[model samples]
Target: MTLDFFSPVSDLVLAHNELLSPQALGKKIKIHSEKKGFPELGDVSIVVFGVLENRNDVNYIGEVFQLNEIRKIFYSLFPGSWNTVIADLGDIKAGETVEDTYFALKTTVCELVKQNIIPVIIGGSQDLTYAMYRAYDTLQSMVNLVSVDAKFDLGDSSKPMKNNSFVGKIILDEPYNLFNYATVGYQTYFNSQEEKDLMDNLYFESYRLGEISNNVTLVEPVMRDANVVSVDLNVVQGSEVSLKQKFSPNGLNGKEICAVARYAGISNKVSSFGVFEYKPSKDDEMTSMLVSQILWYFIEGVNCRINDEDFSDDRSYQKFITLVEDQELVFYKSNMTGRWWIEIPFLSNVNNKLKRHTLLPCMHQDYIDACENKVPERWYKAFQKNSI
Candidate 1:
């Protein structure tokens, strides 16, 4: 059988070393390396993305990527690998069996993540998320999902081969609770009212374009607990953009895209990330540059999350307004063996919409114990500092 998946693709980068790039958000570069492959869990990762097939725009006539630049990005992290492990998940033809592709992606992601290395998946289809979720949860046990896309990916489950529905498969199957689910930039036309109702019942936090545009501060709390983040490039609208099913018109821009990516990386809970739907089929140099910028933002955000211990903000009139609006942050506490969360909304220095809003470890047993029994310990007094 002639396979349409493994089309030859090009890659690039030069001698490995820790060097900064021109548009990088993070000033520093570091990598955790294997003896002859990608870095493991604790090590910082430097993955250079390339299309699985050569479709000119998709892989650029087998000249999909620059090897020298890839090497430069990797080496800039200063990791020493005898040989690099480059994973290409195949072209993913339109009619290809989903099961076959899913398994391949699942196994590959598990392998990379098992080594504790951050596996950054860059490719075309959103179906990649299904395999990613299965892999991370199966191998790592517990994980929370975050999606940054223009649609909820909740199409009909009856049609197995459709563009959307992987997410539907996951949620309807209850493979994981939809409680941790959060999405941004949803289009009304792209999603149905029935689907929205289902998501509400499932407890997924989502914001349409209008809501987020009116107030972006809503994203931080929704993502504070997320572990795996996925982004769809279609959320951006521009002439240079590309995709198999393009619909970026009247959407966010490249800088806003980087802002979200940066937020994901800065999330202390997020461990793995995927950027999908970046089909170079209609892409221009500007699109490539935008993608590159998003990557840099990811690195920079991670750096900021890991290093910045203090979570303070500038106190100003604008900040006060933001704080006032955010004071309605939600709070959730589990009383019955952690099976269910009791959600309550209240105002605070943090953003409201309550239910474990702050990721600052503020929902610990000690806090619960102190508040539940009205028994205040001097030690508990100091625990508030850590928000535990």
Candidate 2:
């Protein structure tokens, strides 16, 4: 079993957990330890684990890191009135080769997901998302990947894989499981003009940092359609993180990043989530606390999830049809949750990547825009991609 690849949580963290209040999360979670063996997964809803591989990072210089501090902080916090059961599955130590580590992670994630368990991964570098994405190859026909990062990470696919270039590999590699890739909180200066052009040419989605910071709710609809969500810690503003972990002077604040995490957690289709690009430092209390809170919000969102996606019955949703120019736009609003979705019309002549008509999550404003004779950019992109 791939569980054997995991090392038990450190005794120091367990000792710390002993000091936490009975009502604290640390006291309630099922943890893997040297004496306790692996925890039973029968009723667990979320599994938290760490990956210790970082050689693929472009700036790597043999620095080692640990998630013990993050665990300690997360355990000390009090969970909300939550019913979801969480387990700490310990960490995956670096293997002899990065590929070996990827194999173990991919296999483990695939196993957990097949059992209807969500895996919240804390990683050493963002490239580990590649392994997370690969885990879905046999599980789903097509995958939607959402990356919260400052850059597109689409380096030359012909070159060796690195943290900055793994997305290129995902787009160019075999099996072709990735259907849509989106970026949230990207800074234009960090990406090249060619990369931006490529994103537009391919009909992928991207939202700038300025756009998201102005209105964080914009992330909800995009996340609702995602299957795999990967967050690069570098997306967090430098002031919100530790000295070693900071990537830019400007990025998502702690609250914004946590909100993004919560949105990911609330998505029914988001099976796997990851927070990556951690560089440990001596003074990491702030970063650790931020990450812990991010995890907390995600769990909170998971516990608050509502099953409002079933639109088979007329009683479950309210449908609206609007004419924008010559296009007929159809939208559905869940009677239970009030969330909205726009439909992508099926193409009879061309082979469809989605294979059938599907709903793209959207906001009420999209319906308003269509009523004004302005087509929503997201609907247009989805329509164009379907035609392609």
lDDT winner among the candidates?
2
Name the regions of candidate 1 deviating beyond 4 angstroms.
Answer: 1-98, 140-142, 239-246, 307-388
Off by over 4 Å in 2: none
Q: Give the 10-residue window scoring lowest on summed lDDT in candidate 1.
A: 316-325
lDDT of each: 0.52, 0.93
Compute each candidate's TM-score over C-alphas. 0.62, 0.99
lDDT of 1: 0.52
State candidate 2's TM-score.
Answer: 0.99
- Tens-place lDDT digits, model 2, residues 1-388: 3777999999999999999899999999899999999999999999999999999999999988899999999999999999989999999999999999999899989999999999999999899999999999999889999999999999888999999999999999989988889999999999999999999998999999999999999999999999999999999999999998888999999999999999999988899999999877899999999999999988888888899989889999999999999989999999999999999998889988876338999999999999999999989898998898
Give RMSD (Å) of candidate 2 vs. truth: 0.8
Clashes of 1: 33
Supply candidate 2's per-residue lDDT for 43. Answer: 95
127-230 per-residue lDDT for model 1 (tens digits)? 67776788765654445677888888877776653346667876766455333567787877888898888776655667787776665645654455677788
